[model samples]
Target chain A: MAELTDTAQQRATGLLRDYGAAVRAKRIRAAMYFVALVICVLAASWSGEVDLRKFVEGLPRFGSYFRDITPTLRPATLGSDIAEWYWNFPVWLELLLETLLVAYVGTLAGATLGFFLCFFTSANISGNRTVSFVVKRALEFCRTVPDIVFALLFVFAIGLGPVPGVLAIAIHTAGALGKQFAEVIENIDLKPVEGLRSTGANWVDQIQFAVLPQVTSNFASYVLLRFEINVRGATVMGFVGAGGIGKELLGSIRQFYYSDVSAILLMIIATVVVIDLLTERLRHRLLGTAKV
Target chain B: MKPRIAEPCDIDRLRTAYPSAFAPGYARRAAALAGISAVVGLFIFGVVWLGFSPSALVQGISKLGVILKLMFPPTAGQHMLVYLQALAQTLSIALLGTMLAALVAFPLSFLAARNVVGRWLLRFLTKRVFDAIRGIDTLVWALIFINVVGLGPFAGILAVAMSDVGAFGKLFSEAIETASPKPVEGVLSTGASKIQEVRFAIVPQVLPLLLSQVLYYFESNIRSATVIGIVGAGGIGLYLSNEIGQQSWDHVSFIILMILITVAIIDAVSGRLRRSIIGAQARS
Candidate 1:
């Protein structure tokens, strides 16, 4: 300690002082943030009319919903006869299957349309910036307007049914997937596109021979992801008279049929889980093959 | 990335070089074509199944044109202030719900993390719980909550929070699992308790990423709150749906404008914040 240089010791104290100041500043900032957040929370609780007392009282009511939702399993009927637990299981399954098909058709149509539009939107691909901007904005508008809203409009125009639901889901999907697919296109290795173009290839040939190969796997992955989301969207589109199990679910809720509500919800949850699993596997397979 | 055809080769030369391929010898191409045709066929079937009528579409468009003409001179009508209030409520619902989700999920995220949770079974169960929660859409949750709480923004808030709990739990836990252990180990080496190590090391590392994700969701939830409102939960969406039903095209257009503006503003603000957060992380 005696051998330490005077400047070195001075430097050490200065560093310590700076560190203390920084820590103090950070603490002050953190405290202010906490206070601000608390105030915001309190204000929102009031504005949103969140009554903690009422919530606590209604907590059991919420719990009862889940209890009702759970299938009853008597000892005698445990696995051998599950009728009472799910009386409308077969009909609900068909409606749920219809829901799945709606999502599938919507996703397929949307992704294909998006595939064409994304090229025009991608900065790296489009030749005309004005066209690109318009296309991008159109896609944004398509997505920004909720599928339910679109469903409502179409229901008004074309009458209430599955067509409106499918159209709504498709437009929403195109809006979302076009943006994502464009990003994928922009991120691709430009060397291939440049190579193809230098070889006297037209735009179509370049996209087909070079760009498509690079992006098809990713495009497929995004489409699958969109399909998963569309399933959820299609479920709710029925609230606006668009067709699917959502129509029945809404009807059940409207009529206060607690048993049917639970039954329909169970089927929806099951369908979502199964679709997620199936799509996850498909994405993995596509990516795995692409990698190889 | 493999080039499908050798570059610098003429189209004619390529065709001559691969005559059999030109006649559809490539299984991949044939399969792709088949898939495309099938998709097109399915689209046609879906249209037919929908009982699509061109005449109806044309009639609908003309009706829509009348609405659009009325909508041109957009007026807020007598409910301008009411519309504004509803919009604010939607924003609040989104904000409050997102924060609530973050608060609930923060601690549970640790339990869900594979690195933090000791037992594989516990982690697996936690993950599945998150998945199940996330499986039910916010609109469904909104409908369910409306049943319990009656109706209003309260239901919307709860719906958003519940769905976000599932999402944030999964995302936050995954972020925690991906965090490097060196800093945690360093903190522990100073005789710190497990809690102290986590508080000092892990939280600092993952908080930014978690918050950015939460922020992004907050923006999207604004749109969701509106959608859920259509189900009678509460928000401007209820008003929008009402106007649409009554064929008050002007009010509907006004509501649409407000929502679009609100969403655009939120998207821009959140985008900047996300960038700044990423920049800070990069610098540090």
Candidate 2:
């Protein structure tokens, strides 16, 4: 009985020793992370010249604005003429359509460009390593810059219009979709392509017979997904004078037209809902997972 | 019998058995597609001719080079304090927004998950809600909230929260869907309640992934928050835009540098945190 008790105690000690080591490692990691975060915050604060006093001063203004919004949302003027002016159906509908068109055109253009690049960038599909590397790096650079910055640059280049917005969205989408497409291509079953190659098919023929078929559905799904994203992006591109519903929204806000703002929000929400439903159905159908 | 001279009937049977080798159908389809491509090519040429000038592109590139020259040797001068404050505000907005979205999404994601919800209609509705929200960019949400709340960090926070709710919900649901079912089943077999099954089994399985995603979003939100600020939701983006509007290209460069450094640091830290969490899970 004494020997058994000693054995049990020794085993418990061993377990505790292992647990202690894990705990210590965890603590050290946590401390290192904390230190890193602090260093980053300090560096940013120093570089940006952030003042604590100004932040404190600004806090009250924020409070006042929040307070104003609550009373402004009250429905006391529901039946008033002002409400009618704010919620004009034709204006809202026109803006919504413009936004949708920008998103649609952008997605189509982006997907087309991206699909071409995907083959060149994909190591599994590209005939040469050097071409794949260059294409992949180009895509990475394209995607690294935020879409809004791209919009700003395009607006500067093309002059202000929905054209700039469309172009910006297209460029960003191409980068993002290209990367996703390449990944999809990389993960595809290579047997089919190999078999085509064995039959003396050239690169283009092999891709057409094997690679394209496997990824077509996925590509379609991503395009639809990008369209949905572009819709939202196109809406706000107007703030930079890139024309859309966002321009109207911005104008309304500047004029303090609260009722108009509410109307626009409702319109946007409704449009988004419709698009969401359509895409979901399309995805399910394309993926062949639709339930009987 | 086979050594006898091949008859015309036997040759016909062989040709019919392998139609692909002898068929004209594939060639005809390829020719039709080529015709369609020609039409598309003409349409593209028409549009390009209508919309743009090649000389204008050359002029624009030269102008871009001049603008880029003005941006070099970034100056952090008199307005440094203002820029810093705005940067801090952006960080706070990102942090608050990410936290709010993560907290809200953690519960809603379960409802969106097909495995967790079990009811197809309910799950479908929740999922669609996420998609609709996500379909709209964070900038749009910022614009909406700027209208609602009146141009400040508060609006920025709300926008980030709203957009992240959609994104986090989708991501979290995907993670939940991909989690190991064995643990959930084990809990269920032990007479655990549905909620308990999720709590004891599903949550643990997906928590690390969910945390990592949330952290990544936080880093992404920092960049997004800056962009929204350009539209007057209050952040360094507003300052950056202002500087650009004034053609203070030096200051614009300075702000860009600040953003780059901040983003890089956040990315590194978050990446480390993700690795550590994954490691812990592996050890367990």
Candidate 3:
């Protein structure tokens, strides 16, 4: 090995020191992040009033509530009958069905409205810039307000029932789906639209012949997803006296009908799971067709 | 053969040969028309049943007018600080919930991840557990926690955390599973322990994604926390609902405006934050 000159050795030492400094800087940065996190956590705990001592003491109570909600028939009454476990299944089932119908109808109506508006709103597809702006603003307004809030107003306007729930869900869906649908439309292959336009097709004809074919599957998928959300929203809307399983749920909670609350919750959960499975399968089928 | 413009007869012959090029099928048209009509029919059915009569609508509009007129002077009223405190509490609930859930989910995701859990049975069971947790709504959890915690933001925080834990379990596990194994193998080749490998390889890969997701959820949880508050868990929602219940439309309007502004601001900030963080990660 060649002998290192004095200057070369000095340079090497300087480079090593610089590298160490860089490493130290990184460590300091990481430490600062940790410190910030801790500070925020402390602040959050203070503001949230989350007393750990109380939480530890209350933990058992939490478990006991769950335990209490669990249905326990007397040993003498024990049997294989499902009805014994879910005494209010028939009434709950009807309310759940109504909730489903609310979602289905709301989604259908919203999707139709959204499908029209999205084409106009898409930046790429310009019929009139002014019209698109107004539609976009309207959709933004619709979506910005939470669905439950709308349900509350509708309850005031139309009186209590699933009708308010439907109206609320539909308006909210129109806003949300319109934005997504417009994005999908904007991202589509514009060549097809251009081709239709070159064939002397009008705006409607162009969208019908070109854009619709490409976007329909995606539109359907979004609608299906919205329907799922609307189902949940419908349930919540009922809490506001808009009508559905939520009304009974609220009543049960208020009356401390612990077993009924658990039973109703279970039914809702089961319905959601089944819908999730169905939608997953349906989405796959639609996407598979889209590829072809 | 001389080139010539196609006559109408020639065009008709071509159209007959390639019908799809010209006319949509009668069946398809009919199906579309039928579908639209059915949707309209159902909407009308619901509308009619809901008593959306023209006169009823006019009457309702007049009633709404009265509320609107009252709501015009959007003042914070006497309890501005109370409203502000409630808003702060809501933000804290969302922040703490998101952070706590992220902390809990980070470890449990390994159990749920198909790539990490060697046994199919363990992974399947873990996923189902996650699913069950997620199947329960945040409001439902809030109600449960309300009875246990005896109201206030503590219950709201727990409710948000519980729901997010379920969501983050699925999301984090998916993130873990999608990570390229090459870096992990490289770490293993260096005679590193399992924990070291995870730290050197997996953590580096997924931490950015985890952070980004937590940030995104923080924004959404703010809104969700408000909803939970409506159930008396505690927040601006409780305040807003009370105002509405008491027919204090001005305060309700003010609170609503605050919510809208807060949400919009958070959305914009999160977008920027994500872009910067992801960009930094990409460069590194």
User: lDDT: which candidate is best?
Assistant: 1
Which runs of model 3 end up more than 4 angstroms from their true locations?
A3-23, A73-81, B1-62
CA lDDT of every candidate: 0.87, 0.79, 0.84
TM-score of each: 0.92, 0.74, 0.89
Interface RMSD of each: 1.6, 5.7, 2.1
Local accuracy of candidate 1 as per-residue lDDT tens digits, A1-292: 6557877999999999999998999899879978987997887777778888877877788998777666667787687446765777787877787777788888888888888899999999899999999999999998999888988887887787787788788889999999999999999998999999999999999999989989999999999999999998888877888888888898887787877777787778888988999999999999999989
lDDT tens string, model 3, B1-284? Answer: 86687776788888889888888688988998998799688767766655457786677778878888999989897989999899989888999999889989899998887766789988888888788778777887888888888889999999999989999999999999999999999999999987887889898899888889989999889888877888888888888778888888899889988888888888898889887778878988
TM-score of chain A of each: 0.92, 0.86, 0.89
Question: Per-residue lDDT tens digits of candidate 1, residues B1-284?
Answer: 88776677576788898887677557887898998899788777767765667887788778767777988777789999999988888888998889988899999899899767789988889888999899888988998888778789888898999999999999999999999999988998999987897899899999889879998999989989887779887778899889999988888889998999999999998899888877778788
Q: List-wise, what DockQ does each model earn?
A: 0.56, 0.19, 0.50
Model 1 CA lDDT for position A19: 98
Off by over 4 Å in 1: A1-9, A79-81, B1-25, B33-45, B48-50, B53-62
- Worst 10-residue lDDT window for candidate 2 chain A reads A65-74
lDDT score at residue B19, model 3, on the 0-100 scale: 88
DockQ of 3: 0.50
- Docking category for candidate 1? medium
DockQ for the candidate 2 complex? 0.19
Error of 2 at B282 (Å): 4.8
